[model samples]
Target chain A: MQINLPSLDGTENITAVCMRPDRYTRLYEALTCDTPVIARGGGLSYCNAGAGRGCRTVVSTCFDRILAFDAEKRLLTVEPGMRLGDLFEFAVRHGLYFPVLPGHPSITVGGCAGFNVHGKTQHNVGHFIDYVERFTLFHPDHGEITCSRTDHESLFRLTIGGFGLTGYITNITLRLIPLKGRSVLFQKRFVANLKEAVEVMKQLSEKVDVLYSWNNLNKTGDAFGEGIVFSEQFIDEETSARDKPFHLFTPDMRSVLRFNFYYRPSAHMECAVYYNMERLTGVEKRCALKATAFPIHGKEIYYLLFGKQGLREYQMLIPHDEWAGALDDLRALMNRMKMPLTLGSMKFFTGAQDLLNYRGDGICLVLDVPANRNSVEYFNKLDEIVIAHKGVVNLSKDSRLTAGTVATMFPEYERFKNELNEFDPKKRFNSALRMRIDV
Target chain B: MSDKKTAVVIGASSGVGRAMARELAYRGYRLVLVARDRAELDILAGDLRIRAKVEAVVSPLDLAAATTSGIQEFVARCAADHPAIERVAITAGQVSDDDQGPTPLPLLESIVKTNYLAVIELVAGFARHMEQHAGGTIAVCSSIAAATPRGRNTVYSSAKAGLETYCRGLQHHYRDTPVRIQAFALGYVDTAMSFGQKLLFPAASAEDTARYMADKMSTDFRVGFYPRFWRPIVMVLAHLPWGVYKRMKF
Candidate 1:
């Protein structure tokens, strides 16, 4: 049969399938009939998590619907196809909220859970699975089964980051939190040195509910730590009513930016330097500068400082006790290597409840520099520095961490894999991350 | 007699595919247009024939339905009737938001079959005939968004990416063969499909992109990135260290 699959990004394609299955049972039957079966949801995954290569049968959970919801209790029972955005709206209306959300609003709940997604507030709430109460899944041969923290806890843990390999997630029961108010108390701060920034974040960690920072990639000198620190706390109903709410929205601006974001300077000196470069218009040198400045676009001058060579970041978590030394060591490394520092930022995280949480009990320093692709040697050197400090790299948000380094960083790999094995022996859900981390 | 050559374009009813059909006709390639919308295809065929003085054939049928055993027969019939066909371009596609409800599994399956699997089946059937006749070119349109996995439209990217990869692999397999395979990793194109979308980046006109692709098909490059300049830009973005890339607003 011919099938038409539409992607979330508005692209479409028509393919031929040998068979189709509405449910897991039907899918299993088709699989047994020599038809390759692949599971699909809203088709939100960046990689091929839902579809199979050369697979003839595709089983979709797009038919999923809400099974139950408890507004007072702040719990929701929904099918795999329920959109994360819709759930958020539903929660907000009920004076509750799903604490974690990725950038895209239209992603499916199943996708969020499947990837074991983390959010900006990962330091506090952990991964999406931490809030999941329980779920019912349909397997190829195992049949329908319910997994939770109590019963099949290992399977539950495995499926959390399993990316849908264990089986088809039919219905999920998520634990939602009651919102004090829709308004947020936002604050921004700036730091001087990397050490000072770390110290500030450690001190702020105890006072704030949510914290994250954006480093000025273009800053230099004593104010290298110049960046934006965003902290938010849920406001009381009375306070919310007094202030105007700034609803965040994304607009379409295509023509202005075809392929790259334009870079601007933060200070007069930076603008002078940019202008001076424009004056030295030799073809070869100008091309080199343009390459270095490519990654830093938009209005952020700090980022453009990394130049166009492109930038690479080495971000990791340090235990609260080790944070001070980690900062000192990082500074020492930078001094010893004479590294051209572009930008740096520090964020405080209140340890998450999940075992795979990277934010255990300290702050994370994300070091950004232009990536020198020609020199694989420097990446290894940076990897060594992070590993020697006993820091764990966030694999989901990384592209350079080697498999060996990732294995060392995430010691729970064996445990996560064991859980994966118990759930999906065939290793159905896989991506570049899995291959990189050797998970 | 004019040595203008001839090309067959499937899915020429509307959108980027229709634009591509017109583009090829404008370039003086005798056209063979196939699509599910017969009336629309006829109108397009007539326009191209009148406007460009290009010989046109409007073969309209449901590509999805034809894939079920009938597709092979259909291709054989086309080859027998249109002996002058030298190049075959597949552009058939479909779009749905699942707004009506959850897309039934059957419908999703049909989409995969039409947009992806059927292309391979049709290519295989056409390649064999084209190969026996000595030489021909096959061009499959795909998208650059396939470079990154998205939360929305997961299956659509997968299919396009998969097809692009498959075509690349097939090109390698047919290195010494007379048949040439070209995969177009297109970014957004200005078409009805993108009518209301306020895209983050400027989109190319289908006509401009199609003309570029058609002009470059005879080149040694098997995979062509439309607008050419985006190749290195997207390549760098795709390989960026995730930590930094994730921080920036897309």
Candidate 2:
């Protein structure tokens, strides 16, 4: 009853400093506190990087402001709170663009840097961390430190995909690339079989700057294992003049329903029905469907259809040569087990400097599974297949990846551990996943 | 509506509970926030503590466990810590529509215990403490679906209806006393719990509903229907004969 309420859960108690500081000195003083600290952005990372665990305090830098932008240098120096979407919009206004952005719009620049997030065009450009000119971070031990390739190279390298284990990222200067044009040529092609899909993706990767695939593993027949490969290429100035700028549009009800149903269906069937009928059908039909599916959505759908009891995501990087075989194995495994995978697909990344970058020279298969007990065997089987190919997994997206698999996947495991230990020697920012991965 | 009043809200991590938490915080009420998800509760509590400058205590607990006795102990402790805890809000019920055969009586009983019984217990424990001093407020979250029974959510609606009726009786019993009993007859709100579901009626935002309910708490109102206007409309509709009400689609 008379307990002290920590601001957020996970690693640190962030209740004390959730407001904007008037001066840099004040902010620095807060960061230098004896309690272990981690900077948080949009609070979207699945793991405990933002919240950590058992840490005395956390400094949320989501309120950081954009101090300056040098259009001529194609560089922008901003506080951590500026969101990736907002940054991208700013770049677009100046006829330049931030080449890398994750799928979610609400993610912050600090988070992207902390995770070194890769986008669809990662195969062509590489991780977002590579574009940074330099960044100023406030560390509890080192005080204020500025890092870049030319400056604090080790700190810089460790910060990317570091999960904020290094220190608080205060301000970062990101290098922007000139956009050929605002128009992006978009195309979606359906692949028939695993081999065909792999071949088509390989061919498309050569011709396209951005490529990703979505496979509905549950559908049978000709469409069974069939997936849509989306390709995009930046247009030239002449093409841009003729074509319209790419405008972001919110998907309509039907599309939204289809996306939610096929992508990440909730545990509840009534929820699924409500989503489908309300968006896909007329008002009268929606009412009728509600009558039949009143309490259709609940924990059972999540527990039975999805996987176990918690949230589950497994993402692994397969080299270009092994992509076909991986896809084949994946298809066979899904079919043999009759497991319903909401999403199964391959993503192409250019490459990343981080030794542990999961996006290397090939396609990455990302599977989003519900954390249900029944789905454990399927996940274990899938993990075995991914490991056999010497593929690496992204810890940021994984909730169910076993420790053995993680140790084998991330090549720079020891090095990352060393860096994390140096920053948080007490291991204060530990979580279930962090403890499992020994990070 | 007491000056510098305090309230404790369970399931305040998101959805209706979160809305109510924000509403009470904005009105300058100290809060004790509880939920299973620590990350969400922390972020919410942090925002409220700073933006509203109200004291907040975040405690994450699994409500469906035997350890929940500790929650009552915690509530009693909070009441002792903050004498201003003049209001208690129970908004921690869930809706599950799984095909695990017919809704079992045990499941229904669990809903009743969580939505109704636990509330009564908490009220009794807190009310006894508050009775020694001045009277306080107890608001229970009951669904509007309780008004009309439907197919899927038979057990859920039944439990909510029971809770609403219980609150009505409690209000009558507490008449002329300083203590107030209120029931929030909530319709669908845009929340993560109801993310994929569509509402048959026009849904009110949790923020708006919370503000409406909190504002009404200071007044003589005992039952607050979200969106204000829906009150008269639903009251008339609930009074309609089953022959006509059942024939018409919600």
Best by lDDT: 2
TM-score of chain A of 1: 0.69
| Model 2: reference contacts kept, as a fraction | 0.00
- Output DockQ, candidate 2: 0.02
Compose the digit string of candidate 1's lDDT tens values, residues A287-390: 11111111222333343333333345566777677766665665555545543434455655555424343545566776544445422355467566666766
CAPRI verdict (incorrect, acceptable, medium, high) for model 2: incorrect
DockQ of each: 0.02, 0.02
Clash tally, candidates in order = 38, 29
TM-score of each: 0.50, 0.54
What C-alpha lDDT do the candidate models reach, one value each?
0.60, 0.63
Q: After superposition, how far is residue B38 of candidate 1 from its true place, in Å?
A: 32
Candidate 2 whole-model C-alpha lDDT, 0 to 1: 0.63
